[model samples]
Target chain A: MFIQLVVSGLLLGCIYSLISMGLSLIWGVMGIVNFAHGAFVMLAMYAAYYGDQLLRIDPLLFTPVAILLLFFLGVLVYQIIIQYVVDGPYVSRLLATFGLGFFLINMAQFLWSPNFRTIKESMVHGVWKIGSVMIELPKLASSLGSILVAALVFLFIRKTRTGQAIQAISADKMGAALMGINLKRIAAFSFGLGIACAGAAGSLLATFYYIFPDVASLFGLIALVAVALGGFGSVEGAFLGALILGLVETLGGYYVDPNWKYALMFLIYLGIVLIRPQGLLGRGKV
Target chain B: MMELVRHRRFPTFILLFGLFIALVFPWVVRDRFAQNTAIFVLMYGLMAQAWNIMGGYTGLISVGQVAYFGIGAYTSAFLYTHFGINPWIALLIGGLITALFGVIAGYPVSKLRGRYFSIATIAMAEVMRISFSNWEYVGAARGIQLPIEKESLLTFQFHSSRLPYYYIILFLFIVVNLVVYVLERSRTGFYFRAIRDNEEAAAGLGINRSFYKLLSIGISAFFTALAGSFLTQFSLYVEPDYVFASSISITVAMVAVLGGIGSLGGPILGALVLIPLSEYTRAWLGKQGQGLDLMLYGALIIVFCILEPKGLMGLWKRISTKKRTSP
Candidate 1:
């Protein structure tokens, strides 16, 4: 039972890790918290729902479309609003992103009316029984998919010239600029990539969980905790943090009342923030 | 004599004007809805003042003020419902308790600076909400209904009239403003401002960063709790949703920011502008459709943050500067 639970937890963690990597990257490189990160994910989930249920486009096939659409949105947001006040007080960025988040969430509510919409997929419902234990196929597939994407992102960041530029900027923006990298293009690309990751995470989420306007708040909070736990700028830390959170949540729910699961995550977050403020993999100024 | 008048007369005039407005506001409104709004403006003004102390003066942008507010509401409601204590006295106790919690929260979080502190406070608020939702004694998700009795100033109760509540909130607002005024001129406020400007430098100067920050948090929590208690009495109900809502924290911060943040009159101006505008917008748009008010509110915040980082006061300053330079 514990092994199955851990397996399921690890799978869910991978999705969380993917979602949070974009957020951490944006924060690390651009110094933009992107409070609207979860909102973008929520919007993509809605798009995926419509695509699968109404347009009959499978979520897997529609992921690219969502990524492209969200990338443009992210770029527009950065160029128009974020860039203007990127050098202002910390609170300005927070408020701008918060305002954007609020606007998007309200827009989603206006369009969707708080209804939990799910995409119907027979493959998701399939379960594999392995000697008195049950494994969810959709969960397994999404986990594997997230891991593969994460690996790709890792390679891209490590090997590609653009990815190296992103790393350079994250490490030191002024230094990178001095090194002849165009700050504007790098920032814009990083923002777009962050949104693209959120887009993919949204499609993965639609496979199991229902999509609603408020769903972003939950996932956003979890991703934040994961990002903090993993280490702010480390992609590997994000994955590890997500896994820890997933296990804690699943185990807490199994042992305690399920209603208190969220509280448990918060408690753990408080503990870590108080005791280990830097997080497991976090470095530099938090 | 003329110079003496210039120094003293302005403050005296402003104080008298404030008093006059407070006394006549209920009568001026006449309608219950408008009176309710007046009461809200005053209550929000107090809450904003509290938020300004921490976020504005101390430079801690807390997003968990709702936790202290929740404590105040829950404490007063619990005391009134269970022990039949007068809410006026219960509110005092609630403020004290919440202040203690504020110290606790401030202790750990004061170590963090900038965005981390804000995020942690938000998480703390969430945790408080979830815990309150599960703790059934205080009515949990269902909310607690205060036993409605005959109107009494001591009980902080009213049957249908908003007059009594208006006076109480106005009194609280005045007291809070006065406190802020006094504190801002004091050594402690100087220390807070110094720490806000530069923490390491303040520490180098032998200023106790943690002590001052915690002090600001405690005082801020006290007033926030008092506002929460006032809300419980005015509404005659206490619920986790209303008290612990993230929107409450946002509203308080919004008021502080939309005004001049660190300025004395910032929160007051913020409340004066935002509360009525939001109320009017909601009333206007509620008849037409859903979510329009929220969309407008969000847009306004974004525009203000982007265009006028220092808020309406900043815009005012800019206009005045432009006018001065035009000639």
Candidate 2:
């Protein structure tokens, strides 16, 4: 039971880490916390849902399409709305995104109402027995897939030229611009990339969790906690932090009352914030 | 004489005029729905004023005033239900308890700056909500119903009449504004202003950042709790969802922001504009479909943030500047 639970949590953590990486990247590079992040994820989830349920496309196959669509949306938003306020106070940026978040959420509510919907994908529901322990095969596979994708992203950022430019911008935008990097292109791409990652994570989540208008708020809060715990900008930190949170949540739910699970997560977040402030494995200033 | 009337007497006259309007509002309307709406507006105005002290004046931007509100609501409701305490007396006890919790939450989270502090408040509110939802004594998610009794000033019970509640909330609103006015003129308000402008510089100047932050939190929490207690009496029911909703916190913050944060009159302006506008939108569109008000509300916030970051006060400033130059 312990092994199974741990394994499940580890997989869940990978999903969190994947979703949070984009947020961390955007925050780290752009110095803008995208309050619309969860909204983006929600939009992507709906896109994936439509693809699978209406178009009869496999969720895995629809991931790339959703990613592309969300990337364009990100690009449009950055160019049209975000760029104008890039020079404003942090609160302005916060409000702009917060407004966007509200708009997206209410738009979803207006369109879909408060009804909960899910795409029934049989691929993620299969179970496999390993020794005496039975594990959900689809969840395990999805977890591994997410981990693989995260690794690929990490490697791409490390090796690719555009990735190097992104890193340079992340380090210092003006410095990168002086070094002949196109700041605007890089920023637009980075926002798009962030949304793309959220798109992938949304599909993965839709496989397990039910989709609703307010689902993003819960995931967004979790992502914020994960990002905060993982050190605002570090990919590896997000991975570790998500894993830790997942384990804590799973164990707390299993042992303590399930209702107290959120309380436990919040307590852990508060404790870390009080003690570390920077997070474990985080080298950057919070 | 004209200049004096414009500058000095105008403000006093406006204050008196506003008070008169508030006093006669219930009598003028006489309709239950409009009176009820006025009571709600006053209640929101009080809540928004309390939120402004923390978010606008202090620049703390707490998204969890709902926690204090919830605590106050539950405290009074619980006392009245279990111990049969007078609702008026229970309001005081509720405010005190909620103020204590505010201190506890404020101390640790106030150490964090900017987004982290806001997120911490959000987390705290969520925790409170979940805790209230699960706890059985206060009726859990099903909510607690106030015992209906004969209309009494002490009991805070009214028999299908909003007149008493309107006056009560309006009184609270006036008291809150007076407190804000007093605070704004005090040294503590200056300290908060300094802290909001620059914490490091304030600390460098030998100011205790934590102490002032906690002080702001306490003041804000006290009024917020008071508003919450009043709400329990006005609504005649208490629930986690109703009191502790994140939207309540957001709306309060929005009012402060829209009216021009860090200003004495901003929340009142915000309440005056947003509450009535939102109510009208809901009344008009809610019959057609749900969420139309929210959609418009979200759009307005976006437009306001993008175009008028300084809020309506900024617009006022611009018009005044133009008038000055036109001569």
Candidate 3:
């Protein structure tokens, strides 16, 4: 039972890691928490859902389309809203993303009608059992997809020119600018890339999870927690944080009461933050 | 001396006039809907004022103040319903308890800076919500419904008319504003602003950062709790979801931001504008639950943040200064 719980928890953590990777990148580079990140995921899910409904395309196949669409949307949002408040006070920056989140959720509600939709006949369905442990196919697919996408993003940040520029900006904004990097363009690109990850995760989630306007609230919040726990800007830390969150929530919920899972996650976060304000794998001062 | 006396007398006259209008507002208006809106504005305004102390002045932008408000409501309601304590007494006790809680919570929370601090407050509020929702002792998610009591000042209920509720909340609104007004110029106020503007500088000047932060949160919690208690007595119900919902915290912050943070009159102006706009929008466009009102609300916040970060007060200041200079 413990093995099964741990396995399932790890699988769930993959999707969480994918979501928070985007958040971590945005936070790391831009110094703004994209509160609308969950909304971006929600939008991607809707994109995948509509793609399947209208063209009879599988969500798996529609993933690239969702990613590109969300990439543009993310860039557009950055150019229009975030760019203005990037240098503003904490209140303005916080409210900008918060309002963006609210606006997107309500816009989704207005457009899609506040009803839950699921991809009933996804390309992946059914469960696999090995040695008395059951793994749902869609969840497994999501985990693999999440890891692949996360790896791609990780490589992009490590190897590519733009990715290195993003890293440079995050490391030291003024120094990066002195090195002839276009800070604005790089910031916008990073925001788009971060959101593109959400698009990928959302498409994967549509295969298993219900797609709704407010669905982002839960995932966005958890992703935020993951980002914070992993330390503000450390992608690897957020990944580990996501995995730990999944384990703690699943194992804690199973052993204790399921109702206390969220509370427990928050309590642990508070505990960790008090002791290590910079997060488990994060660098720099709080 | 003559100029100073005139300057002081002018504000006193305005104060007296404003008091007279507020005292007779419900009676003169004779519109239940308008009275109800007025009551909500005052209640929310009071809460926003409380938020301004910790958020605006102290630079701790907490998106989780609803936790204290919920605690206050739950504490008062629990005491009144279970122990048969008079609500007035329960209100005071609740405020005191929430103040203590604020100080305690502030200990660990005050250590966090900027976004981390805000996120921690959110996590703390979420913990409160989940705990209250799961606690069977307090009826869990079903919430506690207060018994309808005699309509009296002592009971804090008004069955005959909304007039009494209006007056009570109005008094609270005034008292809270008065407290903020005093705090704005007090030594503690300077300490709060000093910390907000530059924490290291304030700390260098022998100011204890965490202590002032705790003091700010405690005072904010006390007044916020008072508002919460009054809300329970007014509505005769206490639900964890309604009181502890994150939207309440957001709305309180929005009110402060919209009116102008770190100003005595900002919340009052914000409440006056926002409550009416929201209520009217909800009434008009919220029939099918299409969320137009919420969408507008969100857009307004975004637009205001981007265009005018200081809000209406900033706009007012700009226009006034421009006019003064031009003339």
lDDT per residue for candidate 1 within B270-310, as digits (tens), equals: 89888988888878875555577777777777887888777
Estimated TM-score for each candidate: 0.94, 0.94, 0.94
TM-scores, chain A, per candidate:
0.96, 0.95, 0.96
Q: State how far residue B140 of model 2 sits from its true place (Å).
A: 1.5
Q: Could you give me the TM-score of model 2 versus the true structure?
A: 0.94
Tens digits of lDDT, candidate 3, B1-327:
654323221144555786788888887898778888889899999999999999988999988889999999999999999999999999999999999999998899898888889888888898999999999998899888999988888888889998888888898889888888889779999999999999999999999988999999999999899988988988888887888987788888888988888887678778989888888787778885797888988888898889878777777666655664574
Give a tens-digit lDDT track for model 2, residues B260-295.
Answer: 777766777778887888777778877665576787
List pairs with backbone clashes in candidate 2: none
Clashing pairs in 1: A231-A282
lDDT by residue (tens digit), candidate 1, A133-251: 78898777777767776677778888999999999998898999999999998898888888888888887777778889988778777887788777777777878888888887878
Over the stretch A16-124, how does candidate 2's per-residue lDDT look in tens digits? 8887888887887788878778888888888878888888886666777877898899999888777776766666677777778777888888888878998776455
When 1 and 3 are scored with lDDT, the better candidate is: 3
Give model 3's docking category. Answer: medium
Question: Which of the two candidates, 2 or 3, achieves a greater DockQ against the reference?
Answer: 3
CA lDDT of each prediction against the hidden true structure? 0.83, 0.80, 0.88
Candidate rank order under lDDT? 3, 1, 2
Show where candidate 1 strays beyond 4 Å: B1-19, B319-327
Model 3 ranges with Cα > 4 A deviation? B1-20
